[model samples]
Target chain A: MKVLVPVKRVIDYNVKVRVKADGSGVDLANVKMSMNPFDEIAVEEAIRLKEKGVADEVVAVSIGVKQSQETLRTALAMGADRAILVIAADDVHQDIEPLAVAKILKAVIDEEAPGLVIAGKQAIDNDMNATGQMLSALLGWSQATFASEVNVDGDSAVVTREVDGGLQTIKVKMPAIITADLRLNEPRYASLPNIMKAKKKPLDEKTAADYGVDVSPRLSVVKTTEPAERAAGIKVGSVDELVAKLKAEVL
Target chain B: MAVLLLAEVMGDDLSVDSTAKALTAAAQLGDVTVLVAGGNAAAAAAEAAKLTGASAVIAVSDASLANGLAEPLAALVVSMAGDFEHIVAPSTATGKNVMPRVAALLDVMVISDVMTIVDGDTFERPIYAGNAIQTVKSADAKKVMTIRTAGFDAAGEGGSAAVSDGAAADNPGLSEWVEDKVEESDRPDLTSAKIVVSGGRGVGSEENFAIIEKLADKLGAAVGASRAAVDSGYAPNDWQVGQTGKVVAPELYIAVGISGAIQHLAGMKDSKIIVAINKDEEAPIFQVADYGLVADLFDAVPELEGKLG
Candidate 1:
């Protein structure tokens, strides 16, 4: 069985994002970039499945700008057997919409015929948690999202999902889509030897045109702005003073 | 443009505040018809009928929908997609789970976690985990969205919209519903609570979380936790209060031992009055806090809990 993990390149989780001065989008010039944190979890899970003998191959794919090859290399270093990079855009500033990304992924899946696709629940950049579910709809496959625990049985997978008030466990048939949540697993760092080996790994590059999919943006960004700032209030020295201040403020 | 609002129903009860907030967003576009679908949604449809501005309530009851397997629910929404120009749902776990699949099947882009309806075709939503706001115009004829309930006010009562039976959705049978392990609590729900008390990794361990809970019980506030706390096993997953966990904007929010990472700030920064009690004076949580107190949570939480009584 093969496990396909779809990763994304986004602003590093540690970096503070800044809106462009022109109100166009986030400023990306000289910004530190890395694979999305959630996608890393997905890659880790896929590699772990291979280690457990449940999967024969782990293929990591990223659909983004040309610069996303670095993210693919990182996934390869982390134990992915091979990688596919769909250069949907040349300009690094352009953000590909999730629907188009899902379509491109669907095209890739058709060719690969992987038994499972493990994807991040949402990208930290756009915060659009849609791709995995959208792919499931396009493929007419079962989906268990925000998965915390996953155990693959004979022809089905039992997954525990982190939900609103509690955890929900569900069983989806094979060839399902599973989206990783925060607590799925702690991802491991790529060793130096693996990093060197990843340089030799095959990374097949393709274009959105190659897949015959229109990677056009359906949503036009009218503007981008920083969130309203919150003012820091005076600090109280004692517990009694804190309570008193809170009382006066709320009342 | 007609709007279909999907309301999640558990047993026989619908979350009025959550549903009403989504209705307020739907009312911005056009007439809204509420779709109450879940375990015992037939009875929940009656409650949906009371939310103001709803044109009608459609109830879809089925045991398969009990766990909100996205495939079947998305199918139901797709079947009804022909009647409305816009299909919207509250940004709950179920809403986020199901809406995009509906959008894909309908061949449209889904706008998730929309904070504002700029116009019929445009919306303002948080990106970069609420650090940056982006205004987007959807080009699709049929718009599919999940409303951020924290952005809009709850629609008032005094409505008696007609309730009607809707055909149950065909189970795709791609997924099987397993038992849910719900953390049964008598306290007000974390999202709807007027006051929220959250702890972080600084609180130390699961045993130490009692002080946070005691403070919450004293003030009748809901208990929440930063991702650090939830990840450390100090708190449960549902108690997480962050960009990925739950977006809450209560009247008053108290951060106990929470250092306020950017993700944690995104979830509660919309809250009206913020109070932070942390030993680290330079903690980012204090920067957004309306009242910042530098103190040990172990000492402050118990004292504050005692004073509230």
Candidate 2:
């Protein structure tokens, strides 16, 4: 079965995000961006399925500006067979909500018709964790989220989901949506040859309007300001003294 | 304005903590309706009825929801979404998974990990691993969301309401629950545990974690580990407490052999009492620690465990 993996470009996890001085939103004019960490897990999981021969073909898709082509190339280096870029993600008024992205993804999925869809649990930037479920709902497909492990058995796959207390294993059929959890597998760095080959692989570009989706955001950002900084407090010498100080100040 | 809480049921019983928290959040929008999903969830329905602010309890027991897994749960929520303006669940893993799907199905934007419900459409959530808080406002007609459990107090226990089968919807396509292989631990759950004793690479090896465990057992605490420990394969991912991992707000948090990386502190700094034990007195963890003890974890943990025991 063909596997489809979705990726997004976001601020590198190590880089601290700064709010725009204008209070419009985060200052993203020149911030460093990379493939979202969770999407790395998605790419890794899809690659693993192909490596294990569970998936016949793997296609990577990204919904964003032309810069997202870099993200799709990164997915290619991770071993996807081809890539699709919804280039109109650069539209001046596109909503930041995952559902708007999902609307475009629904169009892409209809064309590719992959049996399995894999994506990161959530992008670190928004931390919304909504897209995969949104895509599943739009396609009327089943979703197994926060998956730690996935084992395919013919038409059915056994997925181990990471939960609050522990793990829950679930069986899902083909044509399912699954979001990768952190424990799924460590993603591999693209080999030099694969990186070079990624340039040669096919990259298709489409517009959000092609899918009849309004890219305008529903929720407007009235203001985005930095959270207040916490004050550094005194460190007590001993446990007894610490308790006494805390009791006086807080209790 | 009316609110509906999709109460997460543990087995056939009510997760008192989740129900109470969901009710507390639902009170922000309007009248509260607690939804219980599972077979023979009568006990859970009864417990939900006691939620102080909840107007009613809508118990929807079905074999499809027996496992409390997301796929079927989302479908159930979708079938009932038209009745409420606000739908919320505890920001646990299950809620995180299902709530977003509900939003997606309803074609509305969702606000997640909300710490405080300021109004029907506005809320505050922490970003940058709780270092920076973001206050967001949702314009969606139907608000689908999850509340951070630690951010709000649980609803008081005492309201009378009737319980009955709400609605049984069709299970979504493609997913079904099989079995769960839970890592059974004697200590309390890391998120809910009042006391958490965490270890780091300084703890040395996978075997060295037992010292932290012994201390946790003595104090009836949960055992946590730094991201470095989990990345080094010294512990399971579940043991990780950091920005990318679980955010815990406990009553007492003790860090042993931890260097106190910024991301690590972001996860547990909200604890009421913080203690640090590291050979390096200058570890960043000490910056947030109310109590700092400069001693080797190997030497200090056992002594502390002995005293607590």
Candidate 3:
């Protein structure tokens, strides 16, 4: 069975993002960009499924501007069989919401008919955590989210989810959706040889218009502002001083 | 707009603390009707009826819903979607797993982990690991949201809401519960704890984490760990406190040897009073700390424990 993994391009995890001076949105100019950390785990999981002989092919897809092709290429180098880029205009890509992204993925699913769909639980950028669930609903398929462990059998997959109280395992039929969580697995880096080979891999590019998906924003961002900063306080000279200060001020 | 608040319950007992916080969030929108979906939910429904600001409690009991599977719970919420203009629940794992599906089936966008209700249509939420706050206005006719319980106080008791039976929808049977392994603990929950003592990579080894435990026990605080410590196997995955893990806002948070990466800060920077102890005086954790002590955790932790005693 073929597996489809949706990746996203966002600000690098380590980079501290700055809100635009105009309060319109985050400033992304000249900053480092990379595939979302969670999506990298999704790609890693799909590749492992293929290595385990449970999947025939792993396809990585991304929705954004032309730069997104770079993210798809990284996935290809990692282990995806091929890549698909659903290119959008700069403005459209900048403001594309999870619902729109889900719609675009739905169109791709209809065309590819992959047996399973794996995606990141949430993008670190918007942190919406909605796309995978929304896509499953649109496709009328079952979903297991925040999966820490996934085992695929004949026509069903048992997924162990990381929940609030504890771990909860659920079994879903094939042709379902699964979202990757942090503890799923440690992602492997692409070797130099694999990176060179990825250059020759077939990369099919399409536009949102090709799939007839309305890449429109439903939510309007009124403003973006920095969070309240906590001022650094005085340092205590020693344990006795610290204990005394705590007693007088806090305790 | 009438709001439907999903009650978080464990077995037959209601997680009244979290449900009350969710109710507080829902009350901001308009009248709230609580939905208790689980097996043997009568007791939980009775508790939900006592939550202030709710007009009524709807009880949905079934074997399929006993485990709070996403498919069945989402279906139940969708079936009742037409009765209210907004659907809200605490941003717990259950809410995060189920509410998005409900919103999608209803063909609307879900505003998740809402920190503030700017108006009926607009909300404030943290993005970029709480480094930035974004104000968003939704255009959907029906709004679906999960409230970050840390942002609101719990609604008081002494309410007299009515309890009624809710019709059970057919279980999609798309998923089944196998089993669960819960880490039973006698300590206060990390999220609700007034004080939290967290260790980091500098703790050296798993065995050394005992210092952290002893400190927490002395202060009746919850034990937390930075991702680095959890990755090193010094702590359990549940003890991880960061953007990818649990978001906590305790009255006092003590960091031992934690360097305070942005992801780690995202989780605990909301803490009321932060105290950092690290040999490295330049550690980023010191920037957000209300008090800083430059000392090795191995020495300082033991000294602090003795002093507290």
Give the DockQ (C-alpha) for candidate 2. Answer: 0.52
Residue B13 error, candidate 2, Å: 0.5
TM-score of each: 0.94, 0.92, 0.95
Ranking by lDDT: 1, 3, 2
- Candidate 3, overall lDDT? 0.90
Classify candidate 2 by CAPRI docking class: medium
Using lDDT as the measure, the top candidate is: 1
Error of 3 at B137 (Å): 0.6
Lowest-scoring 10 consecutive residues by lDDT in candidate 2 chain A? A87-96
lDDT digits (tens) for residues A41-117 of candidate 2: 89888888888888888899888778889999999988999998887656312335788888888888898889899
- Give model 2's TM-score for chain A to 2 decimal places: 0.92
lDDT of 1 by residue, A1-251 (tens): 99999999999876778999999999988999999989999999999999999999999999988889999999999999999999998888899999999999999999999999999999989998999999999999999999999999979999999877778999999899999997898788999999999999999999999999998898999999999988657788898998888777773
Rank candidates by DockQ, best first.
Answer: 1, 3, 2
- Clash pairs of candidate 3? none
lDDT at A150, model 2: 88
TM-score of chain A for each candidate? Answer: 0.98, 0.92, 0.96
User: Which candidate leads in DockQ?
Assistant: 1
Clashing pairs in 1: none
Q: lDDT of each prediction vs. the true structure?
A: 0.91, 0.81, 0.90
Compute the interface RMSD for each candidate structure.
1.8, 2.6, 1.5
What is the lDDT for B90 in model 3? 93
